[model samples]
Target: MEVSKKNKLNKIVKEIETCQACNLCKNRIKSVVSRGNENAKIILIGEAPGKLENEIGKPFVGKSGQQLNDLLSKVGFNPEQDIYFCNVVKCRPVRNNKDRKPNKQEIEACVKYLNAQIEIVKPEIIILCGNTAKKIFKINKPLKMVHGSCIDYKGIKLIPVYHPRASIIDEVKFNDLKKVKKLRG
Candidate 1:
């Protein structure tokens, strides 16, 4: 079953690499696919690829990635071995030669890839790591009000959390992670 999942995910990754569903693809150096164990029970979904992530073709490789790694480590989770990381939009959104937030149309165009990933991974818990992810999921409430709470969405558990790139207040993030860990376990 795990092998099948990996195979399907690999095929999806290839599709994402060649994807021209949105204009973001035009400016991308590489489609940031995903990272971590394919069979992970926990999946972390961020808004989209940032500058460093776009440069490296890996999601969450910038300072935000480092912060996420540190937080995961502090919480006793191994990013590479325990959890999967991805972004709602695989390609970086660029405007005026600078990284910009993905627009609604762009996100709409790119969401199929993320949905494919969710179907393939079949994670028990999805950590929506920011407002964009929350918005995509139709989680309209502010992150502050729901960051540590879990919601059941179509038989899968969803947890909204602050984006790692957001203000780095360790205590707040840690508390949210604790809630996720508890819910995951």
Candidate 2:
């Protein structure tokens, strides 16, 4: 059986630190589990580790993370104090020996970890940073069509927002900002 939050936070962190469930683990320097207060009220889930995150063994610590931080500040959310942040997969999923996307197997392998994190934090609200993040909620809805809307599932509320990477490529910065605002409200 799974242990309670207080009993398992350290255990879970240790387990994830040594996880090698999929091929991605072979290439990662470190597997990053969720990080934040043990009793965070909001959980932010993103896709997976990027180049910088993989190098640093931290999630959301790149340029995209800066944008996320700005938006969170706008909504009065302090990542270090009020929220827990994690990813759909703990390891970096690479492809073409350069780019990356979390494969089905890797995602499946990490789902248990994600579930464990949720069980520990028991956040009141979950912010899905993209489609992959939304999937963990097991909700049957088109993320694109409902990106900025909120849905309640099994007592917890989820708000799907655009991935910060989307803003890196196009003029979607405005759209992403709007989604963040909607999510906050």
Candidate 3:
């Protein structure tokens, strides 16, 4: 099963590497595929690759990734074995060397790749990090209201949580992660 999962993921990665479905592909250093266990039970979907992620050729790394790591560890989740990380869009959306949220066209172009990752990973839980997943999933409520709530999406457990960018873990996020941990029980 693990071999099958890796094979499928690698096929998707190859497709993402040559993707030119949108303008975002033109300036990318590399198509940030994914990071973490391919056989993980949780799929963490972020907005898009950032500058560091693009440079390093990995999804969800650097400071925000560090914050996520610490949070997950605090909640007794092993970042490596428990979760798989990817983004809404595989390429970094940049303008003036500044990273930006994926626009509608960019997101649309990459939707197939993202869907393929989810299908291949087949995680038990999908953690929607930040507004991107909220928008993609059509959750109208703001992150403040929706962050940490487990909702039934396509019969899968979907939890919307703030994308960790801050250095400190606040009460709500910490508590939310604790709740999310229970979902894996």
**lDDT for every model?**
0.89, 0.76, 0.87
Order the candidate numbers by lDDT, best to worst: 1, 3, 2
Error of 3 at 68 (Å): 0.8
Report the alpha-carbon TM-score of model 1 versus the true structure.
0.95
As for candidate 2, its clashing pairs are none
Q: By the lDDT metric, which is better: model 1 or model 2?
A: 1
lDDT of 3 by residue, 1-185 (tens): 35698898899989888888999988788889899998888998989989999999898788888888898999999988899988999898988989888899889888898888888888889999888877888898988888889898887789999888733356777888888899896
Worst 10-residue lDDT window, candidate 2: 167-176
Which parts of model 3 are misplaced by more than 4 Å?
A: 1-3, 166-169
Tens digits of lDDT, candidate 2, 1-185? 86668678778768877887888878787776766666777888999988788888778888988887777776666667777889999888887667477887889988998888887788888888887888767765876677767688778878787787773443354454455445555
Residue-level lDDT of model 1, residues 9-87, one tens digit each, is 8898889889999888888888898999989999999988988888899998999899999998888788898899999
Predicted structure 1: lDDT: 0.89
Better of 2 and 3 by lDDT: 3
Give the range of the ten consecutive residues with the poorest summed lDDT in model 3.
165-174
